[model samples]
Target: MKKGFKYVFMTLLVVALMLGSFLLGNKMAITTGDKVILNKSDFNIYSKTNQMKAVIDKYFLFDVDERKLEDGVYKGLFKGLNDPYSEYLTKEEFDSFKQSTSGEYKGIGIFITVTEDNLIQVVSPIKDSPAFKAGIKPDDIIYSVNGKVYPGDKLNEATAIMKGKDGDEVKLVIKRKNSTGAYDSIDMDLKVEKIKLLTVESKVIDDLGYLHISQFGEHTYKEFTENYEELKSQNVKGIIIDLRNNPGGLKDSCVKIADYLLPEGPIVKTVDKNKKEEVDMSDAKEENIPMVVLINGGSASASEILSGAIKDYKKATIVGENSYGKGIVQTIAPAKSFGIDDNGAIKLTVQEYFTPKDNKIHEIGVKPDIEVKLPDDIINFGPDFIDTDTQLQKAIEILK
Candidate 1:
């Protein structure tokens, strides 16, 4: 009887263990099995919490809550990424980002970046804005915002705190590198204001037509065309196309600007990972004007493409610090995949861009023919400030 009882207990235990394994496996299959890739050999995504999530939702909670699951999963996933750039922006935050890029967002002007140490730092301040007038400088490490301590290694929380209704005050505790101590809490009253984008600014300085292209916004082509016509009307001796701090936008604008500058030849070519090619639009019949391009580290993407093409074609003299080296072109993919989020949005580096002369402008930046550093004291000018504009000055000297 004792032996029979022991045997029965062992059998029951074995049956219970098998049932538990089946339930766990089935839960994972229902929740996260869909994320598994078929062809990829090296990439694998494993989530043990999905099984726990399934158990809680089905047996314990009995109420479906996607918000809880989404937040839980997102926090879990992003924390592991360890890349400040790699983050999960809620729909609202994502909308804000899109609006900011589209020149539709309202806020006191400031550009920001996350340093390697996970501290948010000011990259630059827009001139005539609250931040600029308040004396915020680049490389100022933000310690706290609005009396709230920074959340554990999360920038999203800090961003949410910084943004609010117009007329709201954001208190910032900042630490400057060369300073002896951190700044006492300073209040920056953010005024909600629409960004008025001016793509082109032209003036004749000493018989030389200076056209500054601030950005490649939506109406860039129209502005550039009108400015070019106006400059021609002025009969300027020469042109200095200033593209400093132009982080580039619409490819069409760059091409249009190149069309106005280049006499002919391919402006740029894009080579895909598969080695396929597409030549960027350019014009050969345009007049080869006596022009100089001014670029710096802030000039990137389309700017790099245009400058590289002009230099390779020997169409214009590139004068400034090295141009930002961004050779990869990203393409939006259609159809949904497991790793991708909504909007069916996937931005994979589809190709590498090359100059008409087949020169690669990847990690290696475009070297200037005449290099001149902008003055550090010129910080007072902010984004609109161009004190000495050493590169522009050099361009003028060359034109003379």
Candidate 2:
């Protein structure tokens, strides 16, 4: 009876040891396996990311660039929002964007955007720029750069390809519509140089002042004031403010310029997502010059803002085709605040702007007082191709 009792005790002790070992093995597996199995109650937002990282670390066959992986994740996060105006900028891209806003850079000096058809279209070439000298025109489609086809998705990527150090040469193959409306490919050789943004161009024509504002950049107001003063000194009868193909810039600059042109009233108003309104008003001092503002399909953002205000105030007669309707205000912020490092940033659409009369021109652009379409043949010509520029002629006649 004593031997039988000892046998049972030994058997029970062995069973307990085996059970303890099994539990320990499972604990180690839960902590060290390629994925962690979490209880439903303990699962959190970050749990899936951790699980994915573990799985990739253990099972991905090829080496991965961790930095690129992180960038992809950041880019994917914004892309998932499905907003085209909102984007993730890399460190390099952010630096380039800053340079652009400062009104200086090394590039071909052209503004571009992706079209609804996914074609890369040149909004306009900066006045007296390498691209302008090369006869690059508005609505020109960029097919390839340096023999490599550029996907028309990121404007910054296309700008980067066109930019290089001084004396560097870049080749572009552009596809433009011919007189028959069929696309024709034209190869261009352009040399990169230090591009100083020239935002304002003015001339006196037949006792009238012609002022073309290519963009509303940092120096635009100062330039606009100087130009206006010079035109006023010339005792011009009227002035034409050309904003055609002007992909807009600084709102403050546009507002200040509008202040010089508008009477004592509200210039523009903006509303945030929280339904808060902020209004910008103009002082009593006004230019009061019989004026006309030119616009086209490429006039956007601040350009639209300026035109809308002028239209509301009857400050100028707007001419040309319908403007590009981009009434959203974009605010830039550092990516680090969103858990991204390496000096990256994002430009997000934060507010919607309206005209002083409370007209919203977001997707629907401001209609011109006189709608005139450029001749198809003249549309593809260089910036100086004014002989066939009927829109400018119409403005000249209006001012005359």
Tens digit per residue, CA lDDT, model 2, 227-271: 989999999999989898788988999999989888999999999
* Clashing residue pairs for model 1: 264-284
RMSD of each: 9.3, 11.9
Task: Report lDDT per candidate.
Answer: 0.64, 0.81
Lowest summed lDDT across 10 adjacent residues in model 1 is found at: 37-46
Model 1 — TM-score against the truth? 0.70
